[model samples]
Structure formats: C-alpha cells, structure tokens
Target: MQIKRKLTEREQKLLQILINERNKGIQEIAQLAKTDIHDLKTIIDSAIDELDLSFLNQNKEIDCTLISAYNEKLKNIEHAIDRLAEGNYGSCQKCGQPIPEKRLEALPFALYCVNCQKKKEEKNKEATQRSYPMREEI
Candidate 1:
C-alpha cells in the first residue's frame, strides 16, 4: 500500500495553530458557561422574592449560543484537518476549484473558494429577505 504524504510545512503549522486555538476556546467557553450556570442559580436563590427568572434563562441562552458557535468552529477545524490529510485542503467544497492562497492565509479553515462563498452568502441573504404568504387580491 502507498503511504499517504503528510501536509506541507505551512499547512501542518496552520492546522496545529487552528487546533490549539479551537481547543483553548472550547475549554474557556465551557468553563464560563458552567460557572454562569451556578452563578445565575445562586443569584436566583439570593433574591428577596422578586427574582426575574428570565435573567437566568437569558444567561443560559447566551451560553448555549456561544457553545454552539465554538462547537461549529471546532468542527470546521476538524474538517480542515481532514482535507489536509487528503491533500486537498484549499479546494472549494461547493465547486471543485482551488481556493486562493490569500483566502487560505486569512481563513485557514475556509472550505470554499471566494466566489462560491460569496454566492452562498448572497443566496442566503436573498432567502432571508424573501417575503412569504402573499396577500390575496382585494
């Protein structure tokens, strides 16, 4: 069986840096979210019969959002590492085209060429802006 080649020096270094940052971010976010869970509960208990439960819920919601975002980043990093292993780290996911080196330098985990990314963003924007349920003619 043919041995697979390792990632290039630059790609390997970028991958390591991305992984390190992702791990640190996930740990920090999880710690903060966990602390907030206790802190908010304590605040609710210490209140003098006028506790706004929404405060704790909102805090939890924010923590959840942050956790989700961090997890998404971690997944992206993982995908990037997989691509690197397969020797196609800088190719667009939507279209089989090489992503620009500059784009890769800016976003080491980018999975699409600029053109495809922009097109996707535009499509998403349009979908969000579309009005549904047209009124019947009066």
Candidate 2:
C-alpha cells in the first residue's frame, strides 16, 4: 500500500482557500435560492393583479438561469474540496500531473492541467463543429 504524503504549507494554504471559497459559494447559493422563491411569489402576485404573464415567464427564466449557474459553481468547488480530501487536489484529473500553482491560485476548481484542458477543449470544439456543420453560401 502507498503512504499518503503530508500537506506542505502551500497545500495547507490552498486547502484553506478552497474551504473559504466553498463556504462563500454556499452562502451565495442559499441567498440566490431564497431570492428565487421570493421572486416567484412576487411574480405570481403581480401576474394575478395585472393579469399579464410576459414578465412572469421572463423573470422566472432569468432567476432559474442564475441559480443554475451558482449551483454548478458550487458543485465544482465541492468537487475540488473532495479531491483535496483525497490527497489529489493539485493533480489534473485527466493526466495525473500536478497543475501549476499559478493556475490553481487563479482557478481553485480546475480539474485539468493547461495542456490537458486545451486538448479537451479542442476535442469538444471539433465535436461541436461536426455536429453543427456550416451550410454552404446560398
């Protein structure tokens, strides 16, 4: 069996950063969820009083989109925290290489190293291009 290495000072700092960011994200998501509920209540009241539905749908859609984004971000942060717990926070998920400290500082939730990330993005782009081929000029 392999032994786990002790966390360095920098790794400790990164763990703290991740924990702080996760807490902050949780608070933001909670606030967003509360606001969404309030907005829905207000939209229903306004729609009933004004007998108009245009604003209701638009407002709900925007709120849902915002909440969805926050939830996705929170998920990423949580995943990073899990990786940290697993003793592999700084390692790229795709290649098992350590991600640069600068990159981690900038994006604590990054799952891939720069090269791996680029490759993944390029592959995604090629797939998207294939699926949505441009039409010839009319």
Candidate 3:
C-alpha cells in the first residue's frame, strides 16, 4: 500500500469547495458561484445538447440514452475525486506507478499514467481494426 503524497491543504480545500458547490442544484450553485443562474443553465443545457448531438447525430429517439451516458461520465468523475481523497490519486491504476504531476495538474480525474493510457489506447486500436492483412506476392 503506497502512501501517495496528499494534496496541499489549500488544494484540498479548494477541491472540496468546488465539488460541494458543483453538486448543488444549478440555481443555488450559480448563486454561490457568484454567476447568473441563466448563464449556468445555458452552459449545462449546451453541454447536454452537444453530448446528444455527438452521441446520436441529431436523432431524437436516443436523447434520453445520451443524457444517461453523460450523467454516468459525471459520476465517474466523482468517483475519481473519491479516489483522490483516499490517497490513491496520481498513480496508474494498471501499473501502480506515480503519474506525472503535469498530467495530474491538467486532468485531476485521470486514472492511468500517460504511458499506460497510451499503450491501452493502442491495444484497443489494434484489436478493433477492420482491415484485412495483405498477402505477399510470389
């Protein structure tokens, strides 16, 4: 059990504040964030619309499914935050190595280190390839 370095006190406080604020109902959260509720509503609405377009390509029939998918992604982000609090953040889930600080700074919810993430993506690409192998000429 490796004890990863804990986030700084300031960072931890900031993260906790942000998480608590973000989870509140949009109207209340927007008030707490010092922004207009209409603007926040617009942002969330646009995000859901963009997700729907990307997932269903303008098909209305799948809108609910797309919304569920997007909500699931948000849940995963929350889970990553829980992992961070448990002193397991910034370490690759697959290889158990420390992830680069830069990566963690850029993406607070990342689960795998860069190398492992890249290799996993490459493996997926190879496994999902649709082309046939070429034959050698005699």
Candidate 4:
C-alpha cells in the first residue's frame, strides 16, 4: 500500500477556508430557521387581526429562496471538501488541468477552470437563446 502524502500549506489554507465557509452557511441557515419560526408566529397573530396574508406569503417565499441558496452553497462547499480529500481539489474537472491559485482562492468550490467555465457558460447561453428566440417586430 502507498503511504498518504501530507497536505501543503496552501492546501491546508484552502481546507480551512472551505470549513469556515461551511460553518458560516450552517449558522446562517440556523438563524434563518429561527427567524422563520418567529415569522410564522407573527403571521398567525397578524392573520387574526385581519391583516393582509399576501405580505406574509411574500415573506415566506423570500425566506424559502434564501434557505435554498444557503443549502446550495453548503452542498458546494461539502463537495469541495470531498474533492480535497480525494487529492483533486485544485484541478479543473472539465479540462483536467491545475486550476489557478487566484481562481481557487476566489472560489474554492469551482469545478471548472476559467476557460472551461467560460465555454460552459457560453454554451448554456446559446442553448437558452435557442430555446427562447426573440420575436421580430411587425
């Protein structure tokens, strides 16, 4: 069996950053959960006063969106941690090249390097345009 290698300083730093980000996300979600419970109580009390329910519904929708966004960020951070454990955290998944240190520092959860990411975005944009063509003015 091969011996495991130690992580470099940069890798350790990246791992710390990912862990910090994950913790922050969890704390934010927990805070949001508490706020949601309070909001629900407020909504019930306000409904008894014949207040507008639509405003409460809008608030609920916004809370849901925030929760979803936080959950997605947490998932990405978890994936990055897993990749770091697998010894491929700083490599581009699409092109199989080492991702730039600056890019990784900016977005530790990035899967594709800059070029591959740009290409993927362009392709997605093209597909979106095709799916919803603009109408010509009459």
Q: Which candidate ranks first by lDDT, i.e. highest?
A: 4
Instruction: Estimate, for each residue in 90-130, the C-alpha lDDT of model 1 and write its tens digit.
Output: 77889979776667767877788988999999998777666
lDDT of 3: 0.57
The TM-scores, one per candidate, come to 0.48, 0.55, 0.45, 0.58
Task: Summing lDDT over every window of 10 consecutive residues in candidate 2, give the lowest-scoring window.
Answer: 44-53
**lDDT of the candidates, in the order given:** 0.62, 0.66, 0.57, 0.69
Stretches > 4 Å off in candidate 1: 1-4, 34-62, 94-97, 118-138
Q: Which candidate wins on TM-score?
A: 4
TM-score of 4: 0.58
What TM-score does candidate 3 get on C-alpha atoms? 0.45
Model 4 steric clash pairs: none
Encode model 3's per-residue lDDT on 65-114: one tens digit a residue.
53445455545545556666676556789999977666765665677998
Given candidate 2, what's the lDDT at residue 41?
42
- Candidate 4 has an lDDT of 0.69
Task: Indicate the TM-score of model 2.
Answer: 0.55
lDDT of 2 by residue, 12-72 (tens): 7777777676566556644655545455445433442232334435445346566556556
Query: In model 4, where do residues sit more than 4 Å from their true spots?
Result: 1-5, 35-65, 127-138
For candidate 2, give the lDDT: 0.66
Pairs in steric clash, model 2 = none
